[model samples]
Target chain A: MQANRSRFLTIMLTLGLAFFYVPMILLVIYSFNYSKIVPVWGGWSLRWYRELFESAEVWSAVTLSLQIAFVNATFATMLGLLAGLAMVRFGRFRGRTLFGGMIVAPLVMPEVITGLSLLVFFISLNQLTGWPAERGFTTITIAHITFSMAYVAVTIQARLTGMGEDLEEAAADLGARPLKVLTAITIPRLTPALISGWLLAFTLSLDDLVIASFVTGPGSNTLPILIFSRIRTGLRPDINALATIVILVISICVAIAAILMFRQQRAEMRDQKMAEGADE
Target chain B: MTASNSVSATPWSDTDGQKPLVELRGVTKKFGDVTAVDNIDLDIYAGELFCLLGGSGCGKSTLLRMLAGFESLNSGSIKIDGVDMSDVPAYDRPTNMMFQSYALFPHMSVAKNIAFGLQQDRVPKNDIADRVQDILKLVELQDYGKRKPSQLSGGQRQRVALARALVKQPKLLLLDEPLAALDKKLRKHTQFELANIQEKVGVTFVVVTHDQEEAMTLSSRMAVMDAGRLQQIGTPTEVYEFPESRFVADFIGSANIFEGRVTEDGADHVRVQTDVCDVFIDHGQSVKEGGKIWVALRPEKIHITKSDTPVTGENQVSGVVDDIGYLGETSIYKILLPNDQIIDVTAPNQTRPMNRQHLITWEDKVNISWEPSSAMLLTS
Candidate 1:
């Protein structure tokens, strides 16, 4: 009976994993096809990859998306760190409850609603003050920051609260002034949270499509927007090649992250052993 | 006791014309609707280890924090070395505190933690290193300077916390529950080591702890607090031997306290009659005849003797032994009096019973008596 149950569970696990990966695997295989049409399998070739790299449209889209993600991560991290510190360390400030609630609103709000409201806001501001006159990189990046910072804020807030006031109090007790304590103790301690929050915001902005589509205008075709518009008409082999390249880049990043995390674990284990084994 | 090193009561007892090291005048603090610490005035002499002891929520910690400038007083003022400290923030205060959690920076090495305070003062890097090395030697953690706090054991972390706070050489060092985080055996050993270090440093130490035994052993003089109020302040000997009130008597250690009436007041001794027995005290306390009073008796102070002669007199009572607890070091006897009162008496177990037999069996009539000075007379 146990053997039968174990066999059933193994089958179910394999099926579930295949269900998630089969479509992506098929797309990757099609990306190497020499045929122009996506579904038809021809002899394998790298023709579509060469075409993707040679296209000016794809190059512009890649640069646009990179720029937006970079700026969004920087601004989101700074603003979110300040917001998080304020929520945790300010004790009681004016509108604290309201700010705390509003800071996490973007995380739960529907993306369509957020994108629509931001688009309406930009249009109104342009009409009122003739500012942000053209909706392109600026509008899309702003909308991206508005939502990504909420993610960063939640991450930072949890870290700040978990670390508690003990470190700060210890610093002050050791005669470090308030500003000195912030620089010498608090910020250094918050480094892990800050780095993770920035990376999360960057990923979130880069992966967004619906919001970018809603806010994007003339000459502002981010990678997602370009691929989405092209796929709306028809599926092409070059788009498959582009997607396969994106998956490759992501896999490389994931592998590097795992290796770095493994090295860190090893270092910590050594420290632990040294601490336990030292006679001194 | 080792820190005091004085045949006299306390080393600083002769501060006839000298100013106190730290003075708290009417210091008060409130948290929202609860008064955490009521108005309290205190004078702590220099080079003495003083303790503030109480149960939880007694505001002993709040008072220590006020001295460290972490908590601002709702009213009143504090002076350290004759300088008003109301305007000084925590970082600029002349006092440094060793937190209860030990609060060593997990990210910094042990040496950096001890050197942090000196670095804040902009001390030269070489001097800071030397001082850190010197303090590490003092705490007996000389070889552990390069290790992180996580790499060290609990006792080592405690020493690092102590070294960090003491390396500053502040006028006053505040410690909050210093030995609370240790195991029972380690706590006892660390208590003496802590006192020895205080003596070596010669800095005024104010420790806040809820453990009565810790306060008694580690303090030359200590204060007990209850309900945000000061209950008593005296040497540990005075507090234990003669507590002024019922609360102090019960809080300090186990005591059999009962209400009684004064039957006679004489120059040499006073007699108090209670429901259980009559108590003859050594000193003449001020009380009118037939006035209501209270008396406390420590279990170890009374002697339990198996007898059937029916003894009757002041400072003596005859009762049936109801229950006997055979603790390894000492046995506690619960005696039942004729008035159905229960009294406790503890006796040392110096001799073992022969052939699996007990010395005092159950339901045996026994006579218990105490010396004149053993019964503490309490009026309040």
Candidate 2:
């Protein structure tokens, strides 16, 4: 009976892994296909990759997406840090509940609704204040920041909640003012959370499609928006190559994040072991 | 030190000419509908090690926080070094606290944690390093300066916290349950170390603790609190030998309390009537005639002997030994009187018997007696 159960578990695990990885594996293999017609692979070659690299449109889209992701991650993490600190550290103040609701509303709202509402709001603001003359990279970056900040806030808030208040009190008792305590004690401890929040915001901004499509204007197409528009015409091997590159970039980023998190966990475990030994 | 010099060896005892360092007048704090710290008046002399002892929610910690300037008083004034501290913030106050958890900065090394306070004051780099090193040596954690708090042992981390708080050389140091985190043996050792550090530094120390033994061992004087009210304030011996109220008597240590009514009140002595026997107190208390009172007798003060022994006293009562708890050093006997009153009598094991049998076995009729002066008359 034990052997039977083990066999069943191995078969189920393989099936689950195949279900997740098979599509990506197929896409990667076909991206190297030299066939003009998809699903009929003639031979494996680097023609699609060459074409993908040569296309200025693809390059511009990639650059625009990178810029948006960079700017969005920086600004979103800053705003998120402020919101998270207010939620966790600040005592109750007026409109706290409303502020919390407003911060979190973007997280659960539908992407289409968010995109459309932001587009309308930007148009109205342009007409009234003439600040953003036209919807483009700025609008797209702002839209991504609006939703990505909520994710960062939730991450940071969870981290701050688990942190003990004694350290801050001890700092204050040691003659450090409130601001000094924040800089010395609170922010140093929050470095790991801030890193993870920044990474998450970057990924969300880079992968965004619907929001970018609605907010972006002429000559400001992001990678996802360009890919999505091309797919409406027909399947292209260069597009597959682009998809493969996106997947590769995301995989590398995720791998880096995982490695960092693993190192942090190991350090934390060492601390835990030392604490436990002390208890003994 | 000579006898006269020793009398004033500690600055706190030089009260003839010295003024108190900290004074609290009618200090009170309220949280919502609950009064955390009721109206309390206290004076702490300089270089004195005082303790606030109570159970959880007894407001001992709240009182310490108020002195630290973390909590504002509802209506009162606190003076430190003749300066009204009501408007002082925690960071500006001339006080520091060693939290119960130690609260060592986990991200910083022990040296950095100790230097953090001096750096906040914008002290010179050389001076901050020198003071940090001195304090690290004082706490005997000089070797662990480069280690993070999490990398150090519990006792080491506790020392780091002490060094951090002491590096600033504040006028007063507040410790909340300073030794409550240690094990039994470590706690005993650390208690002496803490008291020694307080004495060597000569900084006025105010510690809050729920452990009665910790307070008794470390404090020069302690205030026992209950339900946000001060029950009694006195030296360890005073609180132990002559507790003012029944709460204090029972809270500090075990006491055999007997309820009685005062029958005779004399200038030199007082007599009280109980169900089992008439009690005689050596000193006169302010209890009125026929007033309800409680006579408390410590277990160690009660002597138990075989009934055959000729023992005659107004405070003597005969009972059967119901239970015997043979601790290694001391044995406690629970004796049941005729009126079903269980009196605990503790006897030191001065000599061991050759046989395995105890000196006093079960069902032995014993006569328990205590001196009149040993009985404390509490009117509460």
Candidate 3:
């Protein structure tokens, strides 16, 4: 009876994993198809990949997306770090509850509503102040930052609170002033959280499509907006090939990160053994 | 009798008439409606190791933080080295604290952690390195300078925290439960090492601890606090032998307390009648003719013997042994008196017991007697 149940459980686990990955696996296989249409798979060839590499529009969109993600992550991390520090360390200022609520409001806000509201806000601001002569890269980058910063701020806030005020107080008790303590102790200790928050912000900006589309103007297409527009027309084989490459890149990055984390754990365990062994 | 003749021949004697290194007047702190520290006045002399000892939630840590400038007084003043420290920030105050958690910076190496305070002052790099090395050697961690905090044991981390604080050489050093994190055996070993380091540095150490044994061993004089107020402050012997209140008597060590009215208050001695018997004191306390008072007696001070001869006195009682607890070095007898009151009497085991049987067993009638000076009169 136990053997039968174990077999049944193993089958179910395999089916679940297949359900998650079969479509992506199929897409990767078809990207090698020498065909014009996506549904019909021709003999295996690298035709679509060559076409994708030759497309200047795709290259420009990649450049624009990378540029926006880079800038947005930097700005969002700065603003979000300040917001997180103020929320945790400012010690119950007036409107603290409201500020805390508003910082995380974008995380729960629907993408359609957020896009529409930002669109209306920008149009009104331009009408009133005659600013933002044209809306494209700058406007879309700003729009991405508005929502991306929420994730960074939440990440930073959790890490900051967990770190506690012990180290900061110890620094001050050791005779360092506030600014000196921040530099000598706090910022160095917060490096891991800051790096992770920046990466989260960067990924959020790169993955955004709706808000970027709403805020963008002519000739300014992020990679997601470009791929989505192409999909609306019809699925092209080049798009499939491009998506396969993206998946490959992301999976490689994840594998590298996991390996690095595993090595870090081993080093920590060795250090602990060293400490314990030193005692004996 | 009050305990006099403290740990003898100390260099930092109270009669030296030197100005106190730290002085607090009416120091009080309130958290909303609960007062953490209330109207406290204390003087800590330089070169003396002082401990503020208490149980949990007794505001001992709060008082230490107030001295470190991490907390502010509600309506009081603090002075350090004859300088008024009312508005001084934690960084500006000439004090450093070793936190209970150790609070070592995990990211920095041991040497960098020690040199951080010196770097903040923009001291020369060579001087900072020399000071860090010297303090590390003092704590006996000179070999682990380049190691991170995680690469060290708990005792080593504690030493790193100590080295970090002591390198700055502040006028006053505050240690909050410095050995509370270590295991039992390590805590005992480190307690003596901490005192020796403090002596070598000659810094005025203000240690806050909940462990009575730690405070007794590490401190020259200790203050016992309860419920945001100081119950008593003196040498360990004074607080243990002649407690000023019932709470101090119970908190410091084991005591059997009895309540009664004073029968007489003579110039040299006093007598009080209680539930089981009357208690006599060698020294008199100020009391009304028939006012209620409490007397505390230590278990070890009472002599218990097999009841062969009848005994009756003001400071003696006769009872039947109810139970016997055989400790390694001593034996405890729970005796039931004729008046249905049970009292504890402990006697040293001068001879070894065979087959787990001692001189006093269950149902044995025993006479317990204590000297008049052994009974502490508590009139509060």
Q: What is the DockQ (computed on Cα atoms) for candidate 3?
A: 0.83
Model 3 off-target regions past 4 Å? B1-16, B308-310, B354-356
User: For candidate 3 chain B, which ten residues in a row score worst on lDDT?
Assistant: B1-10
Tens digit of per-residue lDDT, candidate 1, span B252-364: 98798889999899988899999877888888878777998999999999998889887888889899999999998999999998888898889999888877777887999
Q: TM-score per candidate, in order?
A: 0.94, 0.95, 0.96
By TM-score, the candidates rank as: 3, 2, 1
Q: Which has the greatest TM-score? A: 3
Candidate with the larger DockQ of 2 and 3: 3
In order, the Cα lDDT scores of the candidates are 0.91, 0.89, 0.89
Evaluate candidate 3 and give its CAPRI docking class based on DockQ: high
Candidate 1, residue B243: the lDDT equals 94
Judging by DockQ, tell me the better candidate of 1 and 2: 2
**Interface C-alpha RMSD per candidate, 1 decimal:** 1.6, 2.2, 0.9
Report clashes for each candidate as comma-separated counts: 0, 0, 0
Best by lDDT: 1
DockQ of each: 0.60, 0.62, 0.83
Clashes of 1: 0
How well does candidate 2 score on lDDT at residue B166? 85
At residue B57, what lDDT does model 3 achieve?
A: 98
Of the two candidates 1 and 2, the one with more favorable TM-score, higher being better, is 2
